[model samples]
Target: MSRTGIATGPNALRGIVMMCLGMACLAINDAFAKYLTDVYSPVQILFLRNLIALPFAVIIAVRLGGWDAMRTRRPGLHLLRGTLWLAAATLFFTGLRYLGLAEATVLIFAAPVIITGISALFLGETVGWRRWSAVLVGLVGVIVVVRPGGDAFQAASLFPLATAFLYAILMISSRWVPAEESLWTTMVFQVLAAGALAGLASLWFWTPVALSDLWLFIGIALAGTLGMTLITEAFRFSEAAVVAPFDYTALIWATLLGYLIWNETPDAMTWLGAAIIIGSGIFIILREARPG
Candidate 1:
């Protein structure tokens, strides 16, 4: 483990690489989900995606250890984390219906900044003035993109903002989970819990999916599960602060996919705001990495 006791080692390069690839996978998954939104409710999409991922999570769990690895002392925390995951996914997918891929992506990227504050408040972690200033700048960036009362504003914009908050809470909670709990087990619990919750919500909004769309559902599930696994491994190898900055790579992927697939382009203000948010987030990560 690293000197910081964050349950990661000192291999920052490997962590950064894994995080970049994982972000790519996640971006592709989001693109697929956005495309499928044309035909399915977000609830149905989430249920199917998790259902397909459950078996893969089980396989990884058993391979990592026996079924015993799945046993955890912190079941309640797992449940809470899973709920947050479900909520974040629901909000993001719903928001995608109204927001372009790049715009939605830049909005959610605000999570890291929100996480810094949440860590300070809820986890009682120390935050220096520099980091706090960075957080404020990041929030300003988000406001610039959201433009609360401007013509660019839409109620749907709030979905990604809320998603970012919930995602921050989920990340903070992960830090509290016992390090001994295998990554596979943590992943399994999260998928199962999210799937169960989504399944319940699906009953009210279920719609028949065409046979042609089955592959898209499977792709979403595989991409998301693999991305989660890679990011989990990334954290195991390096400090979260060291690896997290790479997540901004998703903006690049989102930009390319948005233009190629839908001809959607983010406005100048959106790009400006994204630049500010990303810059502030990177500063926070770098500051946290410094010796205190």
Candidate 2:
């Protein structure tokens, strides 16, 4: 079936479930990246992650169709999307070095709200007052979590917020991509383009990896590639708004992983802010799901 044609009966439910699974993989990947940040720079981590993931992506692309499946008329758009992906990953990984996993996860959840706004402004989609209000409330949740000028705040906290904005842009841009393009093609471009860009940047900050750490780099590649492929498939089988809210599930995974692996815990304020953000995001999803 064509990529866009995958959205059919029962696919919406499947999409939601797949999105949750994808988020779990992503949360685990983030934890691994955070752990590696202790010894490697963000660029180095990004370069390795993308470089390792590229082969798997290429395999998937070929399975979907031969090399011709990866062809695209809109190279510039793919390049732009790839650049945004690189920026988002770099910022989020860098922020993870300082912020607790759960905190960073919650902040990134704000992307749905930003995506809603961007869809309205740039995609020219009609957004009702209710969803707009939800967007505003979601921003409040972000502010609560950041707690700017307060002791809980770190300048690094802004990195995830910026990442969320860039990710929102990437998601919006994806909607513009021709549906006929194979999902594997898009995925391949994302890894290849980001890998090339990060490879150039890693030259200055490169750090030698111990033989023992090779497994971590491999894990990063597998988790990231698999996670993103599942999420992309979820979007293929469901509406973006329908699949998006499930992304908030990442916070739950991140919280558990953070505590077990790093002994990190989110304070009461962070929990409260997360609840607010999640609530607002759910409201937006519900509003969008309704008939106009």
Candidate 3:
């Protein structure tokens, strides 16, 4: 019923499946990126990711509607979105350098909670006490995960925390963009700008990727592009509220992959914090889903 022609009717099963699969793909992509970080800078890794993804983005735009699909008088929105995304990815990847995969993922998963808090503080949106309490609980969850003064905590934890904040702002600003703008248009802008920006930053840190590691780069590109497309499809098939909750499935993927690949086993506190964050996020999602 919306301008984007997304079906938000009673049938949400498709959306749920797409959302879960999308999270899985993204988790796989992150695993690839994490593996590469040992030998490559985050900037270098992301610059190459954007470079590899650019062709796919262009092909998607062309297939969707050729040049017409990419037409947007308001280029600023797309530019800003892309820039924010680049910064977010950079910070997140850097965080992975020091944090375990599941730990880093749990922190970023607080984005929904951050979005709610940001709306109240900056957008002048009215948030009832119940929602406000949930937001507070979410922040507490973040603190528990960060454990700033604890032996287990690292300063790098702030990277993902900041990623969550930037991502929240990115999501909010995206609302200013008209629905008439094609998704591929936004994607192309993201790939181009992120690549260019990261490429510039990578000048000091760039390393030649060996042929043996070329497969990892390709894997990162494929999983990332696919994850982005599938998540988009998830939204198109169902209402935001319907599929949003399933985003937490990324944690499951991250935890399992972390154990199998990196031998990561999160402490009980990490799981506890993740549960609190996930619960608060679900509370916000459910509140938003009410019929109003």
Candidate 4:
């Protein structure tokens, strides 16, 4: 970061690249999970996804500095985060079962806006009026996409809304963890938390996944891990406000992949909602970047 607290020069470019690649990786992970939702419970899929990702996360933790860098004083917070993660994943996958990739992603894209509102209301963060207005505008965009009583409406739309809310809560909860806490420890614990919870849920809803689909689960795991790592690196390299706008690139990936693989295309209203939400996000970034 430069003296102005923004990523400058090559650091800015690196952050942009990391954030863009991270969004693409996450999109790929979601696509793989969407494909599997056709034949498996979200819990079952989440269980395997966590299981597959665990060893790699542990390996990364170990390599981050062999046991020392993997320590955390906040196990309870990590478990809470993991539970939120598990819920968000299961709800999102459930939404995917009925909604197109772009539509679902657009709704989930409200997470950051929700996070700001949460911080101001509950965390005592001094969010100004401009950011609050953007949150409302972003919510209107969400309502347009959801279309409550319209023929396009479905109960499944609530899943992503819930996901955005839960995700915001998850992010806010992270603030409670001490700054000295190891991210690797948080990462590993959350995965284990999801694994433990999902494993229990699987006992009741387990469905046998075929040998053919095993590869898809592994792909989900790998893509998700790559996304998480890149996103972490992105924040390390640049200011959150500087790189956050780039995260919107996930919509493009979701739309393209949905059309190519599943023959799904979002309508004009979806695009309109997406544009509104994205514009609000950009505005929030601009507001935050302005020096107080």
TM-score of each: 0.92, 0.91, 0.94, 0.95
User: For model 1, how does the per-residue alpha-carbon lDDT over 1-292 read when each residue is reduced to its tens digit?
Assistant: 5565444434778898899999989999999999998889888999999999999988877886688767988988888888899999999999999999999999998998999998888778999899999999999999999999998798999999999999988877788889888877788999888999899999999988899999999999999988888888888788777787888999999999999999999999999999999999999887887766
In lDDT terms, how accurate is model 4?
0.90
> Which ten-residue region of model 3 has the weakest summed lDDT?
1-10
> Which pairs clash (backbone N, Cα, C closer than 3 Å) in model 3?
none
What is the descending lDDT order? 4, 1, 2, 3
How does each model score on lDDT?
Answer: 0.90, 0.89, 0.88, 0.90
Model number with the top lDDT: 4
Candidate 1 C-alpha RMSD relative to the actual structure: 3.0
Each candidate structure's count of clashing pairs: 0, 0, 0, 0
Candidate 2 error regions (>4 Å): 1-13, 121-124, 237-242
Estimate the TM-score for candidate 2. 0.91
Model 4 regions lying over 4 Å from their true place: 1-5
What TM-score does candidate 3 get on C-alpha atoms?
Answer: 0.94
Model 2, 226-268: lDDT tens digits are 8887898898788877787788899999999999999999999
Return the clash pairs for model 4, or none: none
Clashing pairs in 2: none
Candidate 1 stretches greater than 4 Å from native: 1-12
For candidate 4, which ten residues in a row score worst on lDDT? 1-10
User: Can you write out model 3's per-residue Cα lDDT over 228-277, one digit (the tens) per residue?
Assistant: 88888888888887788899999999999999999999898899999999
